[model samples]
Target: MKTQIEQIKVKNFRLYRDLHITDLQRLNVFLGANGSGKTTFFKVFNFLSTCLKDNVTVAVNREGGFKELITRNSDPEKNFIEFEIKFRNFEQGEKSPLVTYHLKIGFNHGKVFIDKEVLKYRRGQRGKPWHFLDYSKGIGSAIKNEQDYDPKSKEIREDQPLGAEDILALKGLGQFERYKTIKSFRTLLEQWLVSNLQNEEMRKIGDVGADQQLSMSGNNLAQVASFIHEYHPDIFQTILTKMKQRVPGIDKVDIAINEAGQILLKFGDNSFTAPFISKYTSDGTIKMFAYLVLLHDPTPRPLLCIEEPENYLYPTLLRELAAELREYAVRGGQVFVSTHSPDFVDALQIEELFLVKKEQNQGCSHIFSAKKYDDGQISELYDNGCELGWLWQHDYFKGINP
Candidate 1:
């Protein structure tokens, strides 16, 4: 089954004391003021991906260690930084059961370790959920032959001990094919993209090559653009055609190699005899093209987390960009976006929007779906000819402080 996250619960992670969000749509947009934890929410995905790629300790350290990473005023001795993601696979078949992956990281004696990590699924509606992989600290076991395991019969297991307490169990067990669920989940984590695109980085010349995926900062935009142009010409042409429609004079986007053999991204204009290099392209054009390249990838990432994509782009183009993001989600990839733009919110459906706000007293963040907020008045306003962005700017989304 194609993997898609249905729900997420986070506890004692930075400003999120206990945030539980359900009924997640394929295209999820987070709207909030600064310090409302929108970036922190995206970091959760980055942290999880890092843990799988490296280790829990490395991930924690990358975020300035446990003290800075955990919630404020929380007792480290008692509380654990926890995350729970409930997702289901649809590629295997529609009958695939919901699967939950839970991880708890604790700090003890100035050292970080996995307090508890679990991946479980119920094969049948009547039976107990099977723990495909279970681990705490460095020791754990995974069920062998999980693909054909019958809950009624005794399940075979193996004691797979990780080299270190901070090591993720999925990092080890995901290698074997027998653990189908674990392997898929691990692959999903490894492929999830969290973009923090820097326009300056996108314009920089880079080594020549075909990079199927975009980097976090999009410094490799030229390479990825080259990749699509060479390997997937149809997709590349679609991107160019879309660009021409969006940008006033953009006729084509091409690649060039400098004398140093570095790849220089180029843009063609209908009025100009010569193409414009990325260095001379406007920020909005470079940023928009980078996004088109990312969204048009033939093999989309299982999950994509992008923060503030409205930056650099013209406000008039935000609605269209938002639509493109939604279309990408419709193509089997889950997307999480944080935006401060009213134009972008105006393009979102109530179910696709979430408001992140913080309590004045508790100083912790909470997420409320736009569909269920304020007794459904937001939906009422939306239905009564009020745009979501206008409602937000006029303080209709209470406590948003935007």
Candidate 2:
């Protein structure tokens, strides 16, 4: 089934006191300056999805725990971060339906805890009554116990409340036994939402072994390529062909697993195979390979979030990347990318571009469509010769005559 994130709303979460994001298309792009809370916003969604699928421990560890993650100006008595995400879940051979999920986490006695969680399926433009998945202040197992005692009387007791563990057990049982749809959604997030930063140091060293499935920080690109070669040879060949078109000098790409169990990329020379070292590879080449490894993989993820995709790529390649991202979205994979690259934005549809800006002393963030502002000047710039990054630099958004 195809799935895509439709919207996200955040409250009292790190640099953002309040953030409402409604402009979400298949290929959504967030553009903001450094330290303007762009990555933090992505982190919030990542943390929430991880916590729901795995555990609080995994989420906290990924974000440096409560002290580092919690909002600096958070109220001492009620230090909490809340977010809501709306997603479209497609059924097999059927069109997808919109589903909204809400989550809240807070610090309690120095331990991070989920305060509230709810999932709902929307019928139309308005949201339906939420199916309460996990509510901190709700009658949980006590009601279950009551139901077990008397089958006819399906009434919940108000006074007899379930403890935390009991509530969690009931929720787990509900996911495991009763409701398969919610369980499927949870599983999707757990499996597809890969955070490479979990092993950042190892990835940077390019020491990832040959048999690894996915690269930590894209260091295992060769390993992934090798896996593709052995298992999905057709996809690997297709990627190589496409890459050769982009990079003229590259005759062919191959992954060689050496005796020491290290995987390396071997470029075909006129007469022999030349081993290309990852560390010595150009940044553009490395980034291109990393992206190809993900895109051409046989297993498709429902949603993929990439941070700063413009980090190491030429402006021309950024345009190609943007086009490929669009194709990925068209094929039913939701792609959310955060970038400040104008070339990348120029290659996208105006509706797919979202402008993220921070208002001084507003204690919140604003997201607006680049086309909806002032009769679509931003879109016009992209339609013309101006690149997105340069337009912003020239104060084009500030009503200046750039």
Candidate 3:
């Protein structure tokens, strides 16, 4: 089954209180100045995936406990941090159906607990979505036989006294194959990655191995580069060709084994007869190459979150990077990028773009589509041959403009 989360609803979480983004395209670009909750938005996925790694308690603790995670002016009535994700799940030979997973977390004495968790989907073309996996305060039931049937009707449900509130029901049922939908959803969540790549790590010699996927810090960049070469030569060759095309005088990319049995990245330039090791490579070259190693993986992750991809690259390379991200989307992978580069935004469509900002009066920050502002004048800019990046660079999209 192929799945991608299409919508996010957050309440009392970080700077977001009662926020929802419904229309999510495969490729999403978040444009905002610093301290506008862009990285906080990315942390939403990070938090959920962390929940899968352990429990909500551990996940909450990892981020300095629940108080640090919840919004400062959090609603008094809403004691729990809530997150809801709507996903389009495409099962074998079936039209993709919208599946929603909701979680509410509460904290007590610095301990986090799952206040409420529900996973459901609409049974037919219309009606209330059926809750296949529903649990509250560590006790509830799940519809075992999740085959095509009326979940609204009284179907066979298995009573599962899930041990504790802190432990997620999705975590428990996901381990059993009998809970097919639960397992698939868990696997999908587990596949999500939030990338905060470190340039220094990419520059260093990495472990002598080929990771199935790139690490969050990209410490395995060399191994991933070597991996594609040894396992997927076609992908590696394509990356090399792109590297040469994007980076001037980059003719080849080699993966060499060090005396210590570690993997290193070596680049060849036409000017030099000998290839220069990664230590000598430009920062931009290594960053771009690492991105290729990630985006071109044979088993692409269902969801990817990258922060400021334009960090070390030249402005001209932003367009090429954006194109590759779109290609990843075209291949059915969902990518979310938070970038401040207008050059990168210039390559994105208005529908694929979002503006995030903080309002003093409201005392919160949130993300919104261009359609929500100036009666949809944002799209008109594109019609008038003015790209989103240009308008944003000129401070046009932040507020309504003539």
Candidate 4:
């Protein structure tokens, strides 16, 4: 609830070629066919997070280097992988002016570096916007007195020179608390959770200790479970209550550290006296429990990107899961989910649902709200007692085939 992305723009990044999406919701759901660029869309945040945490070079190399990261069949000479995000932090309690962060990654002669980066916000109701942080390649200038910045008076500025050309300016400047705008954006990037949960990873035993937040993959489910059970008993009990209601016969959930200093998750069934270890539990049970642990975390992450949560979960359970995701968003974390389940879509509001589709021949993806299709026919259909899932399956969302 502190800050949320309202608009995102990407240019020459994989399947997205000059795509601009606006008015993002807190609990946004993306629907698309396989290979229609739903996963690629989520990767945008992952790519930015990696760039901020490490460097531009590392982020590029992680995605198979520059050649593989850029858009396919595009001119390398003219195009650079660019991303721009606009959001409001709500730091002043009421609605605040939009903060814009723009980043450009360029490659030349086998070298990848940050071409440009800027973080700026409009001052007052008019005039030119104030640039809090601005850099190109390895050097630029940033406003030193951001709190008392006055465009009408002489502006105080500081020259910033990074150690490497491939480094993000925010990564360097954010380390200092004086750069409040840069630090806030950096913290937001660091707290984003782009979850692509692997059930197999959740089943494996993990190192001893507790993690306040869940990893992109739910590998440390046991440690997190242990942490919640030991500190936040009320939240843990709520998780158990929800699990029992959704998954029949799940009486209790607990965790233990083995003699080797590894944490193991356990489940109890009312029908049996002996508790079942996570390794012996059903896939649905482990997945559901992992989700519960993640949602019940004491400190919710700023943003959550989950792809296909309906996988390995009962169709009937998906609607409630959708509701839970919305509730988590209500608790101050914005969630982005990509799903193929209609039951999940049926639980969503019109503003929360968007359709992602690849353009014919162009081979690039475009995203827009479902409520905007065919002069609001989709909205009209939904208002007339038709569920979104049925409408989507029947090819009512335009350009999306059943």
Candidate 5:
């Protein structure tokens, strides 16, 4: 069964004081003007998903944390941010179970405390009582008495930690045996895997590690290409076959480790001969190869979030990339993309697209579903031969108070 994110809600985090999003489809495209908090929203979900993974928390704090991460001037004592995820279970009649996971921290009397932490599971829709794994309250005070005969004697006592019952409940899942499957699956999601793309310069090096998992910055393109060619030969051949259809004369892509242990991509002819260096290859050629390799690799389905995939590509290729993404969605993978390119947005349907805008005075952000608009409004513009981008800019989405 395919497991995919169904919804995400965040509160009191960054530029978002409160945000709720629903109707999550396989392919979600976030479209908005610059500085409208598109990247911030993406970071929220990424952080939420990766918090328990080692090094992710530190990376998130470096980006911004409790001091700089939360809303400004919000109650220092009461400020807390929460994240909730809903997952669709393909085995159970496509029923999606909503999981409300929360992490709350605050400062009190010059000390930082994790005020509340919980992972609650709800079988179905809203109003359903949730089954919880962890829950906590605040610290408690203890009374101290000493030296009953000595009136001047003084003694110190420590306070007990909060949520004893909840802690036992989670720990008891194994020994006491409660909700074993749900607890184990929740742990899996917390440790979800990530694979990234390589950078342009590293792709030129032709090093062994260059074929390593693509870094978030896509700095290891060469190594990734190398790894794909060496180990996953079938996947590599599939990508080459697809790319050949688009770019003529591209017979095969090969990656070789040189005398200095550097990785190199060799583009051969129809007859397939010596591995020519890839540095001489054009930027479009490199980018296309990277996309093909990433898409064809049969790794576990993850939340593939990409930024500005249309960058450094010809207009014709942008349409091709969009079509590829749609095919990816149909294959049961979840994709979230943020783009300013009109060609990218026009390639998707109104239902598959979302327009993000910031609300004034509130300093909060919201997403507008383009599909909610009447069909007549969409058809009228389509019949007039208006492109999706032009309609959004001039007719349907312009001049509405955010």
Candidate 6:
């Protein structure tokens, strides 16, 4: 089943004082009201991506340094930030093994540095997990040959020293192919596509002739559209087909390279013989088309974090959008979506849904799966036509304001 992270734990990072999310599915839906930590939760991936793509220092600095990144004013009792991921790896149609990577960092002497980091996995059916890679403050060794396992002792340990204590060991060592585990984890982090699509940005022209993948904030929409249309025509056609089905009066989407060699996106409405430029298209149309393009990319990302996909899209399309996200997951990419729309939530199954809420007084949060409810109870309620969104609206859920 390839490699998929089954669980994640966060401590002293952003709004989550300490949070553990488990039983993660391919198509995970995170439901929460305003200020319930949905965006904060997504920030965890942002922090990790920055660390892997750039460095820990850059990650910290980008988030306004440790002072701003820490959760709830860094309780004197808890002074460090930590994140842990437990994932399952599979190869050749069989489950390979379970692996866990844990990272802890502390801010000291006007700087943030790695206090501890470890990558370990279970060696056999029943036994203590082996620590294949262990490092502290950029000093330590990692296992070279990850496949060779004698089960009693370590094999081929290689000393690794990063250029700086503020650097992430995985970021430095993950470049090599021999360290399969490190490389895989790094790829997942680096390839994560987090969307904060701005409609205004999507309307502008992008740099010339860039083999563009969708950017994190989705500003390179035109360039990405150009890339797909020019390189992967089939995928682009699929996007156009879906776009026409969901969006009204959008027969054709034209992409042209101007004299400056920049790509421009134009919309062709049936009402007009001339095509309308991106800026002239309706917000909902542009947003939905961007989503279709993203979901149908030729090289799908390992993880896609889209916050509030319901925004700017027709309420009626929410259900179809939910199904499309799930389809993307089934087609081999994991999806994480946070939404406030009941229409979108209505389309989700019990196992794929999570309710996230925060306590009023303490500002602490609880994220629980909807699957915790009894199956018979669900069968009875759903059989009676009691939809999940209707239930949510009627105060069936606690801590959420609806």
Model 2 scores a TM of 0.80
Residues 264-303, candidate 3, lDDT per residue (tens digit)?
7889999999999988888888898889888998887888
Q: Tell me the tens digit of each residue's lDDT in model 5 across 1-402.
A: 355676777777777777777878878888877767788887775564444442233534655556677776687567766666666555445544455555665545644444555555543343433434444443432212221212233333334454432132222232322343344434435433233333455355744673445556555777776777778888778888877876667887766777998766787756545645667666667777777765664553455677777776777777788888777766756677888787877788766777777776677777766665444576466557776676766647642323
Q: How accurate locally, in lDDT, is each candidate?
A: 0.91, 0.63, 0.84, 0.88, 0.61, 0.82
Best by lDDT: 1
At residue 69, what lDDT does model 2 achieve? 65
What is every candidate's alpha-carbon RMSD to the true fold? 1.3, 5.4, 2.2, 1.4, 10.0, 2.2
List the candidate 6 regions with Cα displacement exceeding 4 Å.
76-78, 150-154, 373-385
Compared to the true structure, candidate 3 yields what TM-score? 0.95
Q: Output the lDDT of residue 159, model 2.
A: 32
Give the runs in model 1 whose Cα sits over 4 Å from its true position. Answer: 150-153
Separate clash counts for every candidate: 5, 2, 0, 0, 19, 0
Please give the lDDT score at residue 18 for candidate 3.
78
Worst 10 residues of 6 by lDDT: 373-382
Higher-scoring candidate on TM-score, 2 or 3: 3
Q: What tens digits encode model 6's per-residue C-alpha lDDT throughout 1-402?
A: 356778998888877778888989988988888888899888889889888777788899999878888877575234989999998766424656778999998887787788888988876767667676789998988987777765665677889888888778888788888888887777888888778888988887887766557786678899889889988899888888888888888999989878988788988889888998887888999899889888887777888999999999888999999888998887878999998888888888877888787877776776777766443454356558877787777766655674
Model 4 Cα lDDT, one tens digit per residue, 178-218? 88888889989989989988888999898987587788888
Superpose all Cα atoms of candidate 5 onto the true structure and report the RMSD in Å to 1 decimal: 10.0
TM-score of each: 0.97, 0.80, 0.95, 0.97, 0.77, 0.93
lDDT (Cα, tens digit) per residue for candidate 2, span 1-402: 477677888877667777777768888887776666767777775766666555665677687766666667667347667788887666533555566777776776666656766665533455343342435643432222221322233333223343442122223533553444456467556545433422222224333354435543665666667778888889888888877877656667766556766666766534445645555556666667677777765766677777877776788888888888777777766777888777786677777877777665654566667767557777777788776667766777662221
Which residue pairs in candidate 1 have backbone atoms (N, alpha carbon, C) closer than 3 angstroms, thus clashing? 1-90, 1-91, 1-92, 2-90, 2-91
